[model samples]
Target: MIRSIIKNQECFSIVQGLPEPGQDHNLVWLEVHTPTVEEGTILQQRFGIETAKKNSNVVEDGQFLYMRSRLLALDDNGAPHFGGVTFALGEQLVAIICDDANFQSFDIALQRLRRKPANGQSPKAIMRSLLQIANDRADELVDQIAEELEKRAEDISEISDGYNANGMELGVPDLIETMRALNAKEELIALCIETQLSLARTVRYLSSEIDSTNEADLQGLVNELAFDVAGVKEHAYFEHQKVQYLQKSVTNILNIKQNQIVKVFTIITAVFLPPTLVGTFYGMNFAVMPELSWEHGFVYSMGLTLSAAVLPLIYIKRKGWLR
Candidate 1:
């Protein structure tokens, strides 16, 4: 579907189809969502907006600035998904194309534009507004992921203390879930980093090509955006490292638990070994075996076997291994 928003005579209005080509207007924004074959052709023929290739960097084709953006959206389960958004910026027009259900970024930019008077709105201004909105959303999502990782880090630390925040003893399943969450967050952070880097590139190119004259206000806006994007990227990288550390912590905890189990079995075997040897010696049928014919032979063998079992327990306790 294709929708057009036109700023004419200091008023913003939505038009049904693309604004009449070459029609005088202060500025126009065309949003094409999941455009069909014919719609794509019309867009290209009328506005020279064509599909960008696999590249994510902004490029200038003498007539317009073309770039592709990765739009991030969360699903019902709060998982992040990326979609493609193609932007074509011209002298007085900005076209956004995406194969998604909605153009949320455009909607938000439009709402903000409407809140203020439409005085002196230019194509560069509109493009900046859209990019700022996208950058803000990305930052917000990154912040949320950071907060979750912090919480998860605390939870894992508690588990290492032998219990969780709820005072319940930690189990393998709990660690598994924590690992899963960390992995998911890691993937999201990686995606955020990629998106931020892409935006950074776009911002630089947009500033250089579109803001060549360096209008004071616009230059400041671009600089602020670049700064914001860089900060988000750095934060994302930091959280990514945290995720890695948490993963290792979980693995180490699991390994410790397994070692404890093996230690227990080893101690049990040591405690029973002497008794097993004693029982075998007593059961031998050789007539020359000492104490074989004594009246108290059974009693002696029982006492000796019980003593053998208790000795290992005492030794283990003395070494503090039983704790």
Candidate 2:
């Protein structure tokens, strides 16, 4: 879908369809929402663009995606799932291509722009608003991630305390699953940071090339956007780091729990090994072995085997190995 925001004397005049040929080209913003290949072709022709921009990852007929004469750059757009925003600055117009029809960022940035009369619906202002919206959204996500991490951390503490108080046995399955979740969350935030980085780069790259009638005003907006997005990226990095710390802590706890279990089993085996040896020796003392044939030998062998087991337990207790 194509929409035209014609620059009125005071406010923007929003139209539903594409601008007609020889239409009001002076001070207009054209936004394309989820344009098809045919629409892209038409727009390319109308705007005098020789080629359209393609994502670097997109390849067809063994040809890698390269920069087009009109295309500036495309941001990373895989895990984001949401359509990526593409900016194409032409000689006579600035085109924004995106997939989502319900663009929350567009609405927010436009509202902010509307508040300042000095900043009407110019293409440069619209682009700035778009970037601002992205930064704001990213900031909100950071807060949400922080809150979630806090709650999860508390839950982990509770789980640890409970296990320690009960039987000194940690639930390996539950901890392992939670660890996996934290790892996935880390990956998601890292992707957001990457997207923000790409966005900031795109803005800075276009900072010099934006051919606006008002370059001085646009330059400041571009610089401000770069700064804001950088902050968002940093916060995202911090959140990811916290998640990593939590994951590592859980892993260490898991290792300690496993080691404790192994140590207990080792002590039990040690306490029983001597008794097992005694029993085997007495069983072999039959007719050929005089102890087994003698009347008192059976009682003697039983007492000796019991003593052997008790001696190991006493030694282990003295050494505090049983503890």
Candidate 3:
């Protein structure tokens, strides 16, 4: 859908489709979501907007592309790719171009600000407002990721302490899977931080190219956006550290548990070795073996087997290996 928001005569109004060429001078913003070639043509013919190829957000053809920050989405084969809003920032015109569904918050913000006086009435200000919404969305994603990470940390702690979510002892496989899932959350938070940083940089670049007079009124919004981006970047970094720690702790716990199992198996094998040797030695008796010929030879052989097993038990117990 193609949506345009224009600041005309000190008022912010939402228009359903493309504006006619030369009809309005204060048309500050034009948004296209999943537009086809035909829709792209409308903007190109009317406003000299460039139709970018390959759904790419990278700046091309003398048009400055501002990629909307988005969560990471892996494709069918699990490769990370961008799937969010992208706007081309240009002189006297800001195009909200997106092939992503998650870019709707900007529209909601525009609605909230529509009735408010467009006192600034500048394209740069409109651009800043849209960017602010994107940042707000980023903040919300960060908070959500943080909450999920907190819960996952608690779960990992519980498993390390030998308890499950239901207070039962958790198995090794479950713990490993839980820690692995956290990798995806960290990935998501990282994407959000990148989004925040990208938005800040794009806005700065746009601000820089404009004449000082055109950008004078947008300085405050731009500064606030930079601060927000910085704060989010710091928070994302801290959260990323927490995820790493959780992964390490979970791995250590898995290794310890595995080592404990190995120790038990090693002790079992040690204790059984002597008994098996005794049984094998008797099994190899010759036809003229005296002990096999004796009447009480079976009892003697049984006693020897018991003694062989008991000696290793005594030895291992004295060395404090039982526990």
Q: Which candidate leads the pack in TM-score?
A: 1
lDDT order, best first, reads 1, 3, 2
TM-score of 2: 0.75
Best candidate according to lDDT? 1
lDDT of each: 0.78, 0.65, 0.71
RMSD of 2: 6.1
**Superposition TM-score, candidate 1 onto the true structure:** 0.89
Q: How many residue pairs clash per model?
A: 0, 0, 0
Q: Write the per-residue lDDT of candidate 1 for residues 83-133, one digit (tens) a residue.
A: 778778888788888868554555667778887644227777778878887
Clashing pairs for model 1 are: none
**Candidate 3 at 17: error in angstroms?**
1.9
Kindly list the per-residue Cα lDDT of model 2 for residues 1-323, writing each as its tens digit: 77776665666566776766766565456677777778778866776422344655222322111111111122233123334666655444556666565442454444565576455545555666666666776666667778888977865675565464445654777678779888878977777777777677666656756555657777777787888888888888989999999998788878876887898888889878988998787667366787757889988888888898899889889998766
- For every model shown, what is its TM-score relative to the native structure? 0.89, 0.75, 0.81
Native-to-model Cα distance after best TM-score fit, residue 303 in candidate 3, in Å:
3.9
Clashing pairs in 2: none
Superior candidate under lDDT, 1 versus 2:
1
Local error of candidate 3 at residue 264 (angstroms): 1.9
Model 3 spans > 4 angstroms off = 8-11, 20-23, 54-85, 90-92, 101-105, 115-120, 209-217, 288-300
Model 2 CA deviation exceeding 4 Å by range = 20-23, 49-51, 54-83, 99-107, 115-118, 162-170, 209-218, 288-303, 320-323
